[model samples]
Target: MPGPLLRPLPILFLTRPEAASARFAEQCGDSGLRFDTVISPLFRIEATGPLPDASAAGGLIFTSANGVAVWLAQGGRRDLPVYTVGDATARAAEAAGMRAHSAGGAADDLIDWLIAHTPDLPLMHLHGRHTRGDVAERLTKAGLTCGSAVIYDQPAQPLSAEARAALLGTTPVIVPVFSPRTGELLAQERAQAPLLVAAMSEAVVNALGPLHKRDLKVAARPESEAMREVVSDLLKRALAGDY
Candidate 1:
């Protein structure tokens, strides 16, 4: 079967590694949306260590694939209730043979869910060094201790020569910016033009800062599905000479 290129405007993704590119291809293909990717990884994932005690907490939480990987590597529990911030993370948890529970699409939403679901239960949140959310604080307020176990750190990398060329030389690509850091890097490179930013939510939009937001087209949902939907919508709008 052929891929999705039904829309006049081709989608582009701004990410450093081939992972983002590959994902854009699959999602677009499934949705009948044509997309090309740019390598601008923005950050690299680095693993450190597991928790000192490593006892099972009241629940488990994941915000990224790296977090899931690290938790699994550390012999983390596979039976605890897993609260994930993104669909990608949820999928990762499931792939690791764990039961996954989604709490909306972002950390804040997950925190809200935790607040409502188990207000008094202790929880351990697995995340990156630079991850967002104040679930711990909120949980503390509710007389619950939320321990954050940082398994890895993310360091922002730069764009490759090919990526720079694609952003400058070609017409434009639909870059899916999932986090504030990725958005920040892109915002630093171009003041305007030659790229489209598909932000996941209002938080992501603001994370990119005002300058980036001025040029970005946002997604309806903060999930992977919503991000794909925005890619299709933006392509249609771009083809129609409206955006």
Candidate 2:
């Protein structure tokens, strides 16, 4: 007798900004995962205002690549040292010719690192308006002089038609929620399919509240790499009909 046939893997729904989703999809490809992906950004990254003058700051801080892009677009200089919350943001800063340092993790990791290193006084953090961690405040409380500015905004956007269709279909859908805001946005969506979620942190899962899902998994660490691993595990379980 022939062996049982394998079922198709669930579709992966990526709901970050356009550039960010593309980057994650690219990383998934690099990891040799051939699962289908639908990139439907739920937020649009827009510059809030002109970047604050940084001539007097000892160094620059970036918690997201959006901040780096906005700062670069506004003719911001790259001479000052840059400290970032994660490797990806640090890479973005370095690509712009800035001296970049990565805390290799979340905002809390960056704050702790800054508290230990105690870089030049009055570091300037350029970030979006809807950020969670009070990085600048925490650093300052830790005795490191750090100031911050809101340079970008991540306003919500409706899901694309294709995304809606995917969510409405019977096929399984795997969603990797990177931020609590994204999770909240997803909670408002109506999904008929068997939904599996890979949340980046406890906050992301908490944001889902009472949303119905077939399964949920939180990353071991609040980082992109950890999320990727969580996503992979979800995919494997989904294909095996473990959900």
Give the candidate number with the greatest lDDT. 2
**Poorest stretch of ten by lDDT in candidate 1:** 207-216
Best by TM-score: 2
Q: Each candidate: what lDDT? A: 0.69, 0.86
> What stretches of model 2 exceed 4 Å from their correct place?
1-8
lDDT of 2 by residue, 202-241 (tens): 8788998876788999988777889899888887777777
Candidate 2 Cα lDDT to native: 0.86
